[model samples]
Target: MDKDLEHRFITQLEKHQNIVHKVCRIYTSGQDEHNDLFQEITIQLWKAFPKFRGESKFSTWMYRVALNTAITLYRKSKKSVRGDHYEHVLNNLKYNEYNDEEEQQLKLMYDAIKQLSDVEKALIFLYLEDRSYKEISETLGITEVNARVKMNRIKSKLRTILNP
Candidate 1:
């Protein structure tokens, strides 16, 4: 990459690293898997960097690549992974930054999201991140109507999971 583009990529990555972290958290239940997914996302984002035109916000494009990388990486690695360590990590994570109720709710929310299909999880992640239907539709190559419908379904599923 050229100097200007390399600088821009680093700047964008710093700004949007949280998106990759969040996706990795949702897609990979274990620390090792999460780190692997993060690396995969970084690599994919670098590869796709040149194709990023100024048409959409950089974060929006990053979300697409991050989600795609998370799903693909998870699928490719799922068979070899075991989940015995996940509960231990979950227990170790300190949520004292938030109130007890809020922390519990956040954990429950992700637990529910973990059960979703890859497509549903991607839709929910983007929706929760507050992306517009148009941006999501463009990123996912779906119609705006479909994006809206998928988000509605994801919400309903979450409601069922949380309420049940």
Candidate 2:
């Protein structure tokens, strides 16, 4: 990449790193996998950088790239031997600072979310992040009606998991 484009990409990346991190956390159960996914998303974004037009908000474009990278990574990882290690790794992962109740609730939510299928989980993640139905549709290449249907189903699924 040229210096000008490189600088622009870095600046854009810095502004949106949190979005990448949030997606990483939602999609991966293991810290190592999360880091790997983040790197993969960054690489994908850099490669696809030239295709970005100024018509959409940078965050919107980012959501598409990050989601695509994550879904693709998840599919590939599913076929790897190390994929089965996530449960053990997640059980041992530590969090330093949440209060007991908050931490418990968070873990419960994560557990419930992990029970969902990949597509449902993606819809839930986007919904939780407050993406509009149209944007979710565009990101996932589904119709707006399908986005709403999936989100409603995900919510019901989550409720069952949480309340069971």
Candidate 3:
């Protein structure tokens, strides 16, 4: 990449890197895995940057690329996430008060999410990030109706997991 392009990419990437971090955290179990996935997503983003025409918002495009990388490209050997690690994650959450009930519920939710399929996880992540159904559909290459249906199903599944 040319210096100008590299500089622009780096600047934009720095501004929107939180998208990558959120995706990594949702997909990976531990800090080490999160770091590895972050690196892989960064590399993929760099490789795909040249092809990124500014048709949509940069963050939207980044979400598509990062989700695709997490779902298809990144190989996750570890499956189960420890509940204690979720306590660590919960500390960083923006909640004003942290009760053990809330923490346990969030941990259960996270554990349940870990059991979901990659596409389902992506849907939940996008929904949690406040992405609209249209944006979720675009990002996942699914129809808007499909995104809504999938999201509803995912929510139901999470509820079942949490209650059961």
Candidate 4:
């Protein structure tokens, strides 16, 4: 039974590891920070796995856990984030082929995203993944209406950052 549970957890995590990576990428500035954040989130997910009763999609639950883990550690740690290492992470995360103009735009978008607050970043991350407002609210423990409002604000915030 224990092994079965472990197997299930591993399978689910393997399937959704990108969610974890994306969260870490948003919350962390460098590779070491990203790795540590990812490990901590994985640990939190494992601890919470037994109580996970399938009330939500695994990815949704993962977003909650990952976001919480990042927030908690982010608050606790006094160490300052230093040395932006964009090239390493960006190369790994690249997906689509784009022209030079598109690449510049994408870089600007990520730079703007990095400027957002933690909760705002989480909202944007979930939104980018095409999660519904309902899921966003659930994961963030906000009302659907509030989620909509925040998203609008986030869009405005990103626009200002990108343009200004």
Q: lDDT winner among the candidates?
A: 4
Winner on TM-score between 1 and 4 is 4
Q: For residues 1-164, could you state the per-residue lDDT of candidate 1 as single tens digits?
A: 27677667767777677787788878877667776676667767777788988788888888888888777766776433333434332233332221234335578788999999999988888888888899889878899999999888888988998898
lDDT of each model, Cα atoms only?
0.75, 0.73, 0.76, 0.79
- lDDT score, candidate 2: 0.73
**Superior candidate under TM-score, 3 versus 4:** 4
lDDT of 3 by residue, 66-89 (tens): 998887654555333234523432
lDDT of 2 by residue, 1-164 (tens): 27677667777877777778777777887767776676667777777787889777788789888887787777776433233423432233232221235435577787788888877777787788898998888777899999998888888888998988
- Rank the models by lDDT, top first: 4, 3, 1, 2
Highest-TM-score candidate: 4
- Looking at candidate 2, the ten consecutive residues that score lowest on lDDT are 89-98
- lDDT for 7 in candidate 2 is 66
Location of the lowest summed lDDT over 10 successive residues in candidate 3: 90-99
Q: In terms of lDDT, which candidate is stronger, 1 or 4?
A: 4
**Superposition TM-score, candidate 2 onto the true structure:** 0.79
- TM-score per candidate: 0.79, 0.79, 0.79, 0.81
Per-residue C-alpha lDDT of model 4 across residues 44-161, encoded as one tens digit per residue: 7877899999999999999999998898789787343332432233233323221234335456677889899889989999999999999999999999999999999999999999
Alpha-carbon runs more than 4 Å astray in model 4: 78-105
